[model samples]
Target: MLDASSNRINGSIPLKMGEQGNLNYLNLSNNVMSGIIPNDITLLPNLRLLDLSSNSFHGAVPVTKYSFSPLEIIDLSRNYLNGGIPVEICFIVTLTTLDLSNNSIGGQIPYCLDNLIKLTSLNLAYNNLNGQIPLSLVSLLEMNLLNNSLVAQVPDKYRYCFPAKAFVGNKKLCGNIKGLRHCDLPFFSIIMPLVPMSICIGASLFLYSKRFDQIEGPGIQLLCAFLPR
Candidate 1:
C-alpha cells in the first residue's frame, strides 16, 4: 500500500508505476498533478483502493480489457478530467464507493453502472453530464448529482432516495421531484400553436367584411332611395 495523498506532486503520473504488480491501496488524492492519467496504472494486479481525486488530471478515464477484479474504491473527483465514464470500470464487480464529482466530464452516465450492485455511494456533482438518472442507481445509499446539465424527467424510483439538491443546477431537468417545476406544458408553449390560427381567422373575417361591403354598396343605396320614406 502506497499513500502519497495531499502533496504537491506535480506533472504526469509515471508510466512505469504499473510495473509494481504487488502493490495495493494507492492513494494520491489532493495533489497538484496535471496531465493524462497513465493507462498503465489500470494494469496493476492487486490494486484495490485507488484514489486520484482533487488533482488536475485531464482526458478520458482509462479503460482496460483485462478486469481489475480485486479493485473496490475509486475516486477521481475534483479534477479536470473530461469524457465519458469508461464502461470498463463498471466491470469491476467489487466497487463500493465511486466519486467523479466536480470535473468537466461530459457524455451520458453509462447505463452499465447499474451493474455495480455493490455500489453504495456515488457522487457525480458539478459536471457536464447529460441524461436521465438511471433507475438502477436508486439502490445506492448515498448519491449527489448537483450542478450538471442533465435533462429529462427524474425517474420516480430515485425521488425518495435522493433529495432535490442532488439534482439542482440542471435547468432542463423536471419531474415530480420536490423543488423542481412539474414537467407539464408552460403557458407560452400551450398558446404557440393557436397564434397562427388566430391570425388566419382574423384575416378571413376582414376580407369577408370588405367583400360584402363592395358587393352590397350600390344595391343598398338604390333600394333605400326606392323604399317608402
Candidate 2:
C-alpha cells in the first residue's frame, strides 16, 4: 500500500519496483512522469488498484500474457496512451472500474469485454474507437462512450442508460435518445410491404390467361356455325 499522489515525481517507474512483492495499491497520480508504461507485469501478483492518471505517460497499455494480478480499479485516464484496447483486459474478470478515457487510444472496443461480468463503471470517452456497441453489458452500472468514431444503432442497454452527450461527437451514431440520430430501417424490412402486392399481381395475370384459354375453343365452333353445316 503506497500513496504518492500530488507530488513532483517526474521520472519513469523503475523496473525494480516490482521487487515490492506485497504491494497491493499503487497511487502515482498528478505527477510529471513521462514515458512508455512499464510492461514488466506478472511480477506484481498482488497489485489490485493502479492509478497513474494525470501524467504524461505515452504509449500502449501493458498487457500480460498470463496474469494473477488482482487489478480491479484501473484509472489510466488523462494520458497520451495509444493503441487498441487489449482484449486481455477482459481476462481480468475481477475488474470493476476501468477508466481509460481522454487518451489517444484507437480501434474497436473488444466485443469480448462483455465477458467482464463484474465490471460496473467504464469510461472510454474521447478515444478513437469505432464500431457498434455490444448488445449486452449486463453488469455495467455506469458507462461513458462519448466522442469516438463509433457507428450503428445504440444498443438498448445503453440507449437510455447514458445521456446524449455521452454519445455526442460521434459521426454515425444513432439511438432513441433525444437529439440523437435515429436508426434507418433495414432494407429487408423496407421491401417486405411490397411482397403481397407482387403476389396479387401474379395471381391476376394467371387467371386472365386461364380465362382466355377457356374461351378460345368456342371461336372455331362459331366460325363453323356461320359456314354451311
Candidate 3:
C-alpha cells in the first residue's frame, strides 16, 4: 500500500498523478498542502486507498462516480474544507473507513449513508452540520459526530455508543445525551405568560369603566334634578 502519510508534503496535489491508474493506495495525510484538490485524481481505476487528511485543503471535494468505489479507507479530516459532503460519497458501497471531522461544512447528513453497509468507522465531528443523526449508523463499530449544530433527537442505540461529550459545544442540539441541554419549546415563555396577563388587564379595565359609569350616572341625574333648571 502506498503510505505517504505524515510526510509533511506541501503545495497542491499535481494533476499528473491521475495517469497512474495502477496505483492502489495513496496517502498524503499530515501534510502542509493547500489550495483545491485536483479533481483529476478521481481517474485512478485501481485506487483502493486515499488519505488526504490533516492538511490545509479548502473548497468543495470533487466527486465523480469513481470517488467512492474501490475505496476502503478515506480521510479528509483536520482540514479547512467546507461545503456539504457530496451525496455520492455516502452511496459508496465499499467504503469501510471514512473520516471528515474538523471542518466548516454545513447541512444535514445525507440520507444515503444507509446504503453504506460496509462502513465500519465514520467520523464527522467538529463541523457545522445540523439535523438528526441518521439511524443507519446504528450498526457502525465506531462513529464520532461531536461538535455540530445538530437539532434532533438521537437514537438510543447511538447515544449508548457515543456519549454526550461527543456532541458537546452545540448550543442548538438536544436529546437525552449526557452533556447536552434540553431545547425549550418555541413560544413557551411569551405565549404562556404575556397573553394571559394582557387578557386579564383588558377585562379588568372594561369592568371598572362599566361600574364607574353606573355610579356616576345616578349622581349626575340627582344633581341635575336638584339644580334650578
Q: Model 1, stretches more than 4 Å misplaced? A: 185-229
Instruction: State, as a TM-score between 0 and 1, how close model 3 is to the true structure.
Output: 0.75
Q: Compared to the true structure, candidate 2 yields what TM-score?
A: 0.80
Best by lDDT: 1
Looking at model 1, report the run of 10 residues with the lowest lDDT sum: 204-213
Q: Give the per-residue Cα lDDT of candidate 1 at 124.
A: 93
Kindly list the per-residue Cα lDDT of model 3 for residues 1-229, writing each as its tens digit: 5677788878888878787878888899988998887766655777777889899999876566556447788788888989998887865688899888998889988888888889999889999898877878888888888888877556566677765677776766666778876544433222333333323322322111221123222222322333333
- lDDT tens digits by residue: candidate 2, 60-150: 9776656557888889999999998988887888889999999999998888888888889989999999877776653578888888998
lDDT of 2 at 24: 90
Candidate 2 at residue 125, lDDT?
95
**In lDDT terms, how accurate is model 1?**
0.78
Clashing pairs in 1: none
TM-score of each: 0.78, 0.80, 0.75
Looking at model 1, residue 59 earns an lDDT score of 91
- Tens digit per residue, CA lDDT, model 1, 1-229: 8999988898888888888798788899988998998777777888888899988999987657676647788888889988888889888888899899989988988899888889999999999999877888888999998999887778777788888798888887877887776675433334334444324322322111221223222222332333333
